[model samples]
Target: MRIVFIPVASPLHDEKAVQELIHQYKESVKDVDSFTHLITSEEDVQSVNIRQDDVALIGVLTGGTEHLILAIAMRVRATALLPHPTQNSLPASIEAQSRLSLSGYPSVIIKEWPPEASIRSYVKSWKVVRSLKNYVFGLLGQPSPWLVYSSGHDIEKELEERLGISFKFISLDEVYHEYGLIMDDEARELAVQITSRAVDVEVPMNEVIKSVKLYLAIRKILEREGIKAFTIRCFDIIKSLDTTACLPLALLNSEGFVAGCEGDVPALLSMVILKELTGKPGFMGNIAWVENNRFLLAHCTVPLDLPTKYKLRTHFESGRGVGISGIVEERTKVTLFRVDPLTQSMRVVKGKVISGFPQSNQHCRTQLWIESSDSIKLVTEPIGNHYVLVYGDYYEELKWVAEAMDLYLL
Candidate 1:
C-alpha cells in the first residue's frame, strides 16, 4: 500500500520534539513502499534505513507550496500521503527538510478533491508513469478537440518497445456519459450558479449544460476507471462558470490535483512530466499562430479566443464555391486570407478580397505567397489546389482548406 504522511504540527517551537514526531511516524509506516511525509515544523529528520524502505520523500512548506509540491513530485514512488487538516501553515524549512528526505520517485494522489472539476489531470499523468513503470507507451489520447493531435496507438507501441509495458486505447466517454445522468448536488449547484451569470441566452444553453455534464461525468469516470491523471478541454465551459470555481480549483491544486484549458496535448504532457520531475502543478503552453501562403493555423496550450484578425470580415464570394475569409493573428505571425472551394488563399493586394465582397476589394484566389525573413517573396501554386506550410514547431496551427487550393513556402 502507498503511504503518504501529511504532518500537521502547531506553531510550537521545539525542534527536537518535531524530530521525534518524524521518527515515530516514519517508524510506524516504514514498512510501506514509500512515504510522502509533510513536515510543517523545524525538526531534525530521523535516520530511517533508506535502502530497506525504498523511501521517496516530498516536503510541503508553508511558503513554498508550489515548490514543495514540485519537490515531492520528483520522488513519485513515495506512498500516497494524505494532507492533515491541521498542518495547513507549516514553515518553509520544514517543507525543505521533508523534500530533502524524499527524492527520485513518482506519486499518485488518492482523492480527487474540490469536487467541482474532475481529476482527469491526475489520472492521465499517472497513466503515463504507470505505463512507463509497466514498460508501455504509445498511449493515444481521448478524443476531444483539444486532444485531437494526441495519438494513443502511437504512444502505446512506443512505450511497449521503450519501456516494455503496453497501453490499450480506451474511451472514457462512455462512462462519462453514464455518469452525466446522475448529477450531484454540488454539480447541479455549480450549474445553477453558472446559469445565474448573465449569459447570451440566444446562444444555445445546451453547450453550457454539456460542459457541466462533462465536468460531472469526468469525475465519475475517473472514479470508476481508477485513472490517476488525464486532460480535457474545458476553457469555454470553465470560463462560463465565472470566478466562483477559481478559488475552489486553486485549493484542489494545492492538494496535488491538476487542471488546464483546451485539453492541449503538449500542455498535458508537459504538466505530467513536470509533476514527475518536480511534484507541482504543470503550467500551460503559450499561444501561437502560423501561416504560409495557403492557410492559417491557430494553436495554444489552453483554450484560445480565436484571434479577431481571423474573424470573417466578408460573406462567401459565391456563397457556394467560396468560404469565409479574414485575417489570422498568432503571437507574432499574421496573415490576411480568403477561403474558396479549392483553397484558403492569402492576400496579394491587401484589401482586394474585401472589395470582391459585392464592392469590397479583397483578393479572392486559390494561390498564396509567403514573405521570407530576407524580404524575398515566394509565390506558391496549389498542389492540386492546396498549400502545405510546415509548422516550425509542429505545435503551430493551420487551417483545413478544401481541394483546388495550393500553397508554397519561400
Candidate 2:
C-alpha cells in the first residue's frame, strides 16, 4: 500500500511551520512506501503523480487546502484527512468531510495529524474494501423456515446498488440433480479426502461419503456460476434427500469460499463483508445463551481449519445426517456481526472464545463459549438472532464498512 502525503500550505501561511509538520508526518508513516509532495501553490499539484492505487493523506496545514482537495478528488474518489490535532482545525476537517460526502466520495477522518495506531489499521482495511466491488454472491435455496423475517426476503438488488456486491439465487433442485452425474469413483475419492479430518465418525461412512459428493456437486455449481460466496438452505436437503450440507459448508469455507448455512442472506452478507475486510473466513452461529461475560454460541459446523478438535455427529434437530462436534479454544479474539437487510445495517460485537461448551441435543452440535468485554451490552442489545463469526477484533474495519456503504452499525 502506498500513501501520498499532500501537505497544503497557502501563500499567507508560514512555509517553515508547514515543513516541520510534514517532516513529522513523514516520520510517522515511515514503514510504508510513502511519497511526500508539498502543495505551496495550486500549480504544484500538477507535478505529482496521483495513481489510482494510492491513498491520499491530505494535511490541512493552511486555510485554502480546498484547491489541493479539488485537484485530488477528480483523480481519486477515496481520500482521508490528516487534520491538525487542535480545536481550530477540526471543524474545517469536518466541513471538508461533509463536502466530500455530498459530492459522493468515500472519505475517512483522522482526528490527529500524527494518527494513532488504530487509525493506521483502519486505513489498511478501508483500502481493501474500496477496491472490492461488483462481485457475485450465490444464495442456494431460500432462508431456513424460522428466519423468514430476518433473512428470507431477497434484498440482493438493494445490496448490489449500495455495496457493489451482487447476489444471485441458485435453484436447489438444479444443483442436487447434477450430483448424480458425478463419477462414482471420484465421489468416493472426494469422500475419503473429506472424512480424513474427522477424529470420530458417528454416522455411516457411506453417508458421509454421499455428503462429500453433494459438496463436490455444489462446488461445481458455484464455479460454473462464477460464485465465490454462498449460503445454503441446509435443512431442506435433510428433509428432501436425507443428508446435510454442514460438511460441505465447512469444507467450502475452509477452502476460502464463504458459505453460510440455512440459506441466511444477512448472515451470508456479514460473512462476505468480514471476508473482504480481513481476507479470512467467517462462521455463522446462533446466540445459544449468555451468562455474565461468557456466552454460549453454537452451529452445526465451522470452517474445517478452525476447530482445535473435531468429531462427527448426527444433525441435532432431525437426528439424521452429518453434524460436526468441534472444540475451539479459550481467549481467542473474534468479531461477531449480523447484517440487517431491513435497516441496511450491520450489528457487530467483539468477543473472545472463552472455551468450548458441552452441547444439548436441542441445539446445534458444535458449540463455543465466548467472553465479551461489554458482555451485558452484547446480551441485552437487540440484534438479529443469528450472527456471523470471524477470528479477529475488527472494530475499525466494520466501522469503515458501515460508513462507506451507508449502513448503520449498532
Best by lDDT: 2
Top candidate, metric TM-score? 2
All candidates' TM-scores? Answer: 0.31, 0.83
Worst ten in a row by lDDT for model 2? 27-36
lDDT for residue 248 in candidate 1, whole number 0-100:
24
Worst-scoring 10-residue span by lDDT in model 1: 395-404
Give a tens-digit lDDT track for model 1, residues 1-410. Answer: 13234443334435575566556545433323444344443341232223322323332212434354443334334423322222342344344445534653333232222211212233232333443353211122343443433333453344344335444343534534454475445455654554444222222344334444555555555455554445443333233332112222222333454443333333333343344433544323221112442221221211111112211111122221111222322332323222221122321211111111112234331112223332112223321111112212111111111100122221
lDDT of 2 by residue, 157-241 (tens): 6766655677788989977787777766777876776677677778887788777878888999999999888888888888777
Please list the C-alpha lDDT of all candidates, in the order they appear: 0.32, 0.75
Question: Model 1 shows how many backbone clashes?
Answer: 66
